[model samples]
Target: MKVRVLVSLKPGVLDPQGRAVHHALEGLGFAGVQDVRIGRTIELDLADDTNDEAIDRMCRQLLANLVIEDYSFERLGDGESA
Candidate 1:
């Protein structure tokens, strides 16, 4: 089974890295760039028998910092759904 986890900061949080990237993009002549937010994606290839609960635990325990970010996951395979 393949899992893709998207981890992003909560809406009210400040993302300095994203801001820096946005500035750099403008400096490089990219036009009309309004804003940028940085986040992380984690791809995991797990056993076919892995369950949703375990995945959720992984996200809570290590994959995301619950205090500052929100995370979502998708199972990526023809026979799977999240």
Candidate 2:
């Protein structure tokens, strides 16, 4: 089985890296780019019988910083789908 985890900053968190990228895009002449926020995606290959509760625990314990970020996970088969 495959799992995908998305980690992102919570609302109201300031993202300086995202802001810098947005500015760089404007410098490169890309218009209509309103805002940008950076996040992370992690992919894991796991045993077939892994459960959602365990995945959630993994996210909370290691994948995401609960104080300032939020995360979610999706389980996939041999062919990935979310």
Candidate 3:
């Protein structure tokens, strides 16, 4: 099974990297941009029998920082990879 975990900073959290990118875009004459936020994607190829509970534990325990981050996951088809 292939699982993709998306981790992002929660609302009201500061994202310096995102801000920098936004600034750079404006510098390059990209207008009409309002704001920016950054996030990460984690891909895991696990055993077909892996359960949701185990995957949730992995996110809560290690993949995400509960203090400032939020995460969601999707199960990918068997043929998917990147």
Tell me each candidate's TM-score.
0.88, 0.92, 0.93
Give the TM-score comparing model 2 with the true structure, all chains together: 0.92
Please report, in order, the local distance difference test score of every candidate based on alpha carbons. Answer: 0.94, 0.90, 0.95
Q: Give the Cα error of residue 43 in candidate 3, in Å.
A: 0.6
- Model 2, span 4-31: residue lDDT tens: 9999999899999999999999999999
* Model 3 ranges with Cα > 4 A deviation: none
Off by over 4 Å in 2: none
Cα RMSD for candidates in order: 3.0, 1.7, 1.0
Among these predictions, the greatest lDDT belongs to 3
lDDT of 2 at 1: 84
RMSD of 3: 1.0
* Candidate 2 local Cα displacement, residue 12, angstroms: 0.5
Candidate 3 local lDDT, 13-76, one digit each (tens): 9999999999999999999989989999999988999999999999999999999999999999
